[model samples]
Target: MAAYSVADGAEVARQVATLPDGGSSDSLCAGAWLSAAGERQAFNDDFTLLAGTVPGPGNKGKTATAFSVSGGSPVSTGPGATASDDRAPVFQSGTSTLWYVTGDRHLTSRDLKQPSAAPADHGTAPGQSFLLAGDRPWVRAPLEVTPDQAAVAPGGTVAVGSNLLWRRTDPAASFAEQNVEPAVLGPSLNGRAPVPGSEAMPACAARLWFDDLSLLCNARNTLLRVTFAPDHSRVDKVETLIPEEQGLIPGAVLSPDGRSLAFLREWAGTVDLYRLDLSAGAAPVRIASLAAGAPTGSGGVGRDVRVIAWQ
Candidate 1:
């Protein structure tokens, strides 16, 4: 794994740990959640999960069940048979919050610091607890909601995806929807090599980044920054930063500080990860490259190194 310092543009790469050689890289990319315990609840293996202090600088402590997706109902060790519909899990220790979008199209949360990094030897057998999601999903979707389409913002606001950008207060509040009328933002990436055999209209999906006063999303390949009205009434302004690409931009996630943006672009079978330092007026830096292809491991299906949570 490599850690890039945004401040100095210095890249430091180190070996995190040798992954189990048994699984394909695609399934190995299933999910990675950094627990408040300071250990990462990474996809331990193809089908099993293990929690231990990732032995390294700044990463220590343990791992545990962040919920399981295998079998029916998406059972969780989250207690009380609290099952969920998705795999993108975000753990924020500050609020002791665990958040994820439910299969029923709602953004749910619970107040539980991840369980202590338990012994992996107990076997990857999922506990009978069966609780996968938080008891109450704070945000509900008028339409189907997908994984990694929700983000928790400051000041008790939750932003979710549903074609239109929606926002609501924390603890199960009504959602206020905002529509964005896309306008041209000049041509696409200046030096970006276009995807081979481009499709006419890029498949549009929205990924959101929300702060107290602003929300940012990528729709129709355009990255738009929006400001909400006082008292969370409505969207007041929509400004385009990165315009729609000619080909496609599959995924994006905002940095923890919400200042930088990381996006993925796949060529043939390899996926490239890039980071845009929004705070710095610097060009987006090429960070890491990953292998993405047909899945064949324990979990035969998973995103192409799709980044679900960042913090």
Candidate 2:
């Protein structure tokens, strides 16, 4: 059954839909963005939906068909539409600029308002790459240290990876080679370590930046709230939001107000959606049962169930 709901967890009317390629929905990769007028617009990677041929592996092809969330026929963004190397397009907040990485790995931006206009190519420096921290674009230097995860602060500070946090004060600046002291995890509630003793704790990858100094992260199967020192030199504190005992949390999206987090948990061949209030000691409540045997994408986030937007 297809489930559609509002932000309040109230079930809304549902309409049946199919992929443009006539393929199972499992192969679809979808995302959402807010328009200038605050309407939620959704896009997906079903090339045929726009009458375009799907690109083969590592080939550049037109993707990203835009549609209304309230219900409407999907529209093609045009023949030139493409996404980043990851097959996902990053929409800039408060603007129609769609930022993505081209097949050559160069950072590119296209204006959705004028879909046919040529995209602006922001050439990456030799041995460098670009990424989106929230809605802001940033360049990672020396590309050798490929970050497993990253997050950007409002003032331009960026934290990459967990354990030994790689940090930089500005987008154009090189990362500080010195290892910042690792975040100290709170004691395990069940007296169990994430891993066996002395094997190194699981890396807590940043999922979303809560503010300029703090972010929400996922370490193994747990959620952590990490706050950095003012100088960005070391972790000031770490609080366990969701313990690892709850099972694997593959993906999560924070509410716009930062008061709640919606995440996907998988176990026993079943996937479920749960929402946790950020309030003190709040627990996650199962909101919906997604699908059985759902396929997970590159980062282990389920492709069958995606949280497009949280109003």
Candidate 3:
């Protein structure tokens, strides 16, 4: 259910998403929404650029995967021989960008609009140029950050671990650490009271609609809604809209009209996609689901399928 993100350079932009590990999940695939169906047709196995075409018998229902690889693979020069991790891919300014860490431990981005053998940089570690600060203790996980375009603070900051930090790349300054203020936690996300010092945020997407600021986060298998001030410096309140008890809510997208949420959930080796009406408070309605005998560790595990973008 986790999603992808976009990495930004000085004047360039790229989007990224991670394919689940081949051993624990399926193969490592990544891309963005590039076709008419509103789904991204990612290259299979490796993180190669793919063309939009019909899938073969072995990949029916995998509408996102229209065809095979169309461009050559990127030059692996960052962390490992291949990519150490495929972080979240995101869309911005009419482009979809994906990120990959190389053997040398550097974050690189690929532009799908114009495939590139060379990717730009943010810095070392996950939060260098990426927006959403991912929370991965096991291995550094990727949280594709979404900036509130209408109201991005001086530096886009998010709750990272016990502290808050900005995910901005500064060629002139080193990364600084900041903390979420106590006053900011005065209100709870849901109706329940917020446990003092217990609200540690995972990777978060802070989006803006006109002057309204809202955020989307995934924690303990539940999706979080935390709206903030116009400048995005402090937390206003928090709400647990999609309760974790339903299932693991990994990938989610707010509808363009801002009326509902489209998400993917996993259980019993199956991943089902659903839509929740945020305004009506109605139960989620099923949209798409994996067929029987589909790949394991899909959906919630973020191995194969993901919600790249929502319209």
Candidate that would win on TM-score: 2
Q: Per-residue alpha-carbon lDDT of model 2 for 1-311, expressed as tens digits?
A: 23445344455544444434422211123221111111111232211121112343355443433333334344445455454332234445545565555556666666656767876766652222334544445454222223223444666654543333444544454322233223233333233222112123355555666777776776657777777677665566777887677556645777778888877677655677788899998998888766643455555645345443454
- Cα TM-score per model: 0.47, 0.62, 0.46
List ranges where model 2 is wrong by over 4 Å: 1-89, 102-106, 123-129, 134-136, 141-148, 162-164, 169-202, 292-304
What's the distance in Å from true for residue 242, model 2? Answer: 2.2
Q: CA lDDT, every prediction?
A: 0.38, 0.49, 0.38
Candidate 3 matches the true fold with a TM-score of 0.46
lDDT of 1 by residue, 1-311 (tens): 33444445354532233332221222124332111111222232221232211111223311122323232122133542223333334443334344433333444444444444221111121211111112223323424433233333455444434233344434442333222222111222334322222222232334554566665554544555656566544456656666455523555667878777876554445555677777634566667655433232233322324543344
lDDT of 3 by residue, 213-302 (tens): 555545546666666665555656667776557555655666767677777777656777677788636676677564342345433343
Give the clash count for each candidate: 6, 0, 31
Q: Report the alpha-carbon TM-score of model 2 versus the true structure.
A: 0.62
